[model samples]
Structures are given as structure tokens and as C-alpha cells.
Target: MRIAVTGGTGFVGQALVSALLARGDEVWIISRKTAQDRTGQERLHYATWQQLEQNPALLEGTDCIVNLAGESINQRWSAKAKARILNSRTDAAARIAKLVGALRQKPATVVNASGISIYGTSDTKTFDESSPAHINDFLGSVVEQWEESARTIPAERLVLVRVSLVLGNRGGAFPLMSLPYRLFGGGRVGSGRQWMPWIHIEDMTRVLLFCIDNRDIAGPVNACAPQPVTTDQFGRAIGKAMRRPHWFPVPAFLLRTLLGEMSSLLLQGQRVLPAKLQQGGFDFRYPTIESAMENLVGKSSKPSV
Candidate 1:
């Protein structure tokens, strides 16, 4: 298999690229710059957006396309930041679609990243692949527009991968999220009862691979774990995994005061389940919070954490 990945240098994209290479799949990484040392890596190649614009044939033989390019939403939600967050996703999707249109042989599968916020924040609601989108906030709207843009791609099978909070130790929100726990200051954020739909980075990458292999699977597939934890439960799990005390609680008002609209990401969440993956017989390596934490933080000891 040959895959073309946008945002290949990002947290999720890097994981996916590594997995693809390990499985002996040729990977073509499309990005803004190509400076990585590709020495001795015959199957790994990088192409800048400028190069792709000049020759779409750079990915001519690509069998699959995974679109994960987007601006990070972790910062303060200033007006400019909001525009960038939204535009980056839609613009990336538009470019992928146009590139696919220009391809001599379009890829059969497109796994475009979406957000679980499309279901809106709900303490009582359980969302699945079949659930209707009930977007309310800025991220939700951005995801809605992002999915719309992805729908324009000329793939025979398009999988709108609605990802939740991916838990990994290397380069994601996990390290920062676990920082307070490592400092023995971990506890619930906001109401503590808000749901935190999540998946381990391992399972997240495998789910994308499953999407490409499973031809029958398409549409808005939630890439979250089966068991959704509350924010309190998540913090407790983190503390336990890191051998720390979950005792420090940050006030919701404080987060809102500091992060503005972005605070909603940590303060509010929906219960999302990977219904399509489960139904399609996709096995998750870390299906539960405890299991995910154990894998990510290690048992009995932490490694360079």
C-alpha cells in the first residue's frame, strides 16, 4: 500500500506514518517544508505543498490519503487564532480535493480527520457514528465545515474520522495534561462530571489503518474508545498511572478567564463511541482508561516521562 499524508510531521500524522512504514507501506508525506533526513529510508518520501502544486504526480501512485492538517487549537481563542483554526482545516481539505481532482488515478480511500465536538457537549447523551451532528460551539462549527469540505474529495470511499482526545506520552496534549499529575496536583477540571471521550495514540493509528483496509466502512466514524470517562475519572486515572495524588482542582472560571473559548475543550466533552470500528471488528489495544494509562505511562515505573 502507498499512502499520502498531509500534516505528516504532526503528532497523529507522525504516528500513522511510522506505522505505515513499519507495515512496509510506502508513505508520501505532504507538508510545507521537507527537511527530515530520509537517509536509508527507501519507502519514506516528503513533498512540500509547493512541489505538489507544481506536480500532483508526486503522489500519483498513492493508494490512500489521510488528511490531518490543521492549526492547533490549544492556544487562547483570539479572533485571529479562531480564523486560523477554521481556515487551516477547510483550506487543507480544499487543497486535497483539488489535488485529487488533478490526479491521473485518484486514491480509492480518503481518511479525513474530523472532531468529536460535532455532537456538542453532553453529559447525558451518548454519540456514535449514526448520531446526528448537533454542533453548538466554535470547534463544533469548524468540524462541521471541515467535514463538508472533505466531502468534496473524489474518493470512492471517504471516512470522516471524528477523533477524540488522543492520549500519548511523546508529543500531544497528554504530557501537559499529565504534568499536574506528575507534580502531584491532578484533579478534576470544571464540573468534574463532563465526559472526556478519548483513545490511546496506538489505537488511534490502528483505527486509521483499519479504515483504509476495510472497504465497506465509510462516513463519520468516531475514533474514540468504547469506554468514555468523566473528566474526574480521567484525572484520577492519570494520578494513579503516574503514582501521584489527584488533589488539585482548577476552577472552571479560572480556565475560562485564561483560555477564553478554548477552555470549553477541557471543561466540556461528549460521550463518543467508536461504533463503526467495533461493528467492523476493529480491535482496540487500549479500550479502557486504565488500560490506556497503563500503556502510556507504564506500570510500576515511568520511562523518561
Candidate 2:
């Protein structure tokens, strides 16, 4: 299969590209900046998003297109950052959809990345693909527009993966969380009761491939692990993995003072379930938080603190 990936240089995109290459697929990466041959691999190619838009011929033989372009939402939601977050996604989606529409031989599938933040801050309810979107907040509104932009692509299979917090060895949310633990400043956030829906990066990439291969799976799918851990539990798991004591809680006010609106992501969360993925018989490689943390940190010689 020949696949074109936007944001292919990003954390998730890099993993996805490697997974595709391992399967002997030709991968083309769309990015704003130019890359140098990707460790000198011939199969990997890079092009600016502008070049892709101008040269619609690039989509002629593309098998699938995965759009993962977006600004990091973890930073302070300054007005400029918020606009970049929204435009980066919607603009890329629109570009892809336009290319797909104009393609002489359109790709069979399009997988656009969404986020569980689209569900907003939920206490008890577990959201699935069928759950109504909470578009009132900034993150929710951005995702809502992101998905809406992708829907314009008239592909045979349009998959919108509402991804949760991605836990991985290299990047995404894990390392940042592990930092405090590594320095022995680890602790829970706020009341530590907010549910943090997450999936191992391995699982996330596999699920994307699964969606591409399985024709029956379409529409919105929750790309999250079955087990949903609270912020406190997550903090404890990380601390334990690093053999550090999980004491002291960061007050919500302090977080708000520091991170501002971005603090909401830490202070509030959703209990999201990968309803569609589970129903599709996709088995998780790391189902439980404990098991996932163990794999991430490797076998700890000492007992967890």
C-alpha cells in the first residue's frame, strides 16, 4: 500500500510511518519543513503541504491518506496558539479533501485524527463513538471542526479516530509525565480524580492499521485502552514505575496560575472507552495501566513504591 501522511514527522506520525514501512508499504510524508531522506531510507519521501496542494498528481496512486496535522494542545491556550490549533487541522483536512475530490484515482480510505477531548470533562459517563460531542469548550470546538472538515472527503471509507492520551516509549504524553517522577517531584494533580483515558502508542498505531485494513470499521472510533485510570492513579503508576513515592498533590489553583486554560486538560478529563475498537475484536497489547507501565519502564528490579 502507498500511504500519504500529514504531520508524519510528529510523534504519532513517526511511529505510524515506521509501522507502515515495516509492512513494506511506501510512505510519503507531508510537512512544512523539509526532511533529509529519513535516515537515508529511499522509500520515505517528504513534501510541503503547499506542494501537495499544487501538485494534485501526488494523489494519483496513493492508496490511503492519514491526516494527523495539528498544533500541540498542551501549551497555554493563547489566542494565537488556539488559532494555530484550529487552522492547522481544518486547513490540512480541507487540503486533503480537495485533493481527494480532484484525484483521478482517489484513495480507498482516509483516516483523520480526532481526540477524546472532544468529549469534554466527564465524571461518570464513559463516552464512545455514538456519544454526543461536547463542543462548548475550545478543545471540543477545535475537534468538532476538525472532524467536520474531514467529513467533506468523499472516500469509500472515512475513519475519524478520536484518540486518547497516547502512552509511548519515545514521545506523546508519557515522557512529560515521567519527568517529575524521574526527578522525584512526582505527585497527583489537583484532586487526582479526573479520568485519564489513554492507549499505548503501539496499540494506537496497530488500531489505525486495523481500521485501514477492515472495511467494515468506519466513522468515529475511540482509540483508547479499555482501562481508564484517574489522574491520581496515573501519577501513582508513573511514580511506582520510577520507584519513587507518590505523595503531595499539586493544587488546582496553582496549576491554573501556571498553565492557565491548559490546566483544564490536567484538572478535568473524560472516562472514554474504545467501544468501536473493542466491539471489532481488536485485542489490546497493554490493557491495564499497571501492565502498560511495566512494559514502558521495563522490568523494575525493585518493588513499586
- Strongest candidate by lDDT: 1
Off by over 4 Å in 1: 300-305
How does residue 70 of candidate 2 score in lDDT? 91
lDDT of each: 0.90, 0.86
Q: Model 1 TM-score?
A: 0.97
**Can you write out model 2's per-residue Cα lDDT over 187-271, one digit (the tens) per residue?**
9899998999999888888998998888889999999999999999998887776678798778999999999998888888999
Instruction: Give residue 207's lDDT in candidate 1 (0 to 100).
Output: 91
Tens digit per residue, CA lDDT, model 1, 104-202: 989999999999999998999898988898979999999999999999999999999999998888877888998888777788898899999999888
Residue 131 Cα positional deviation in candidate 1, in Å, after optimal superposition: 1.0
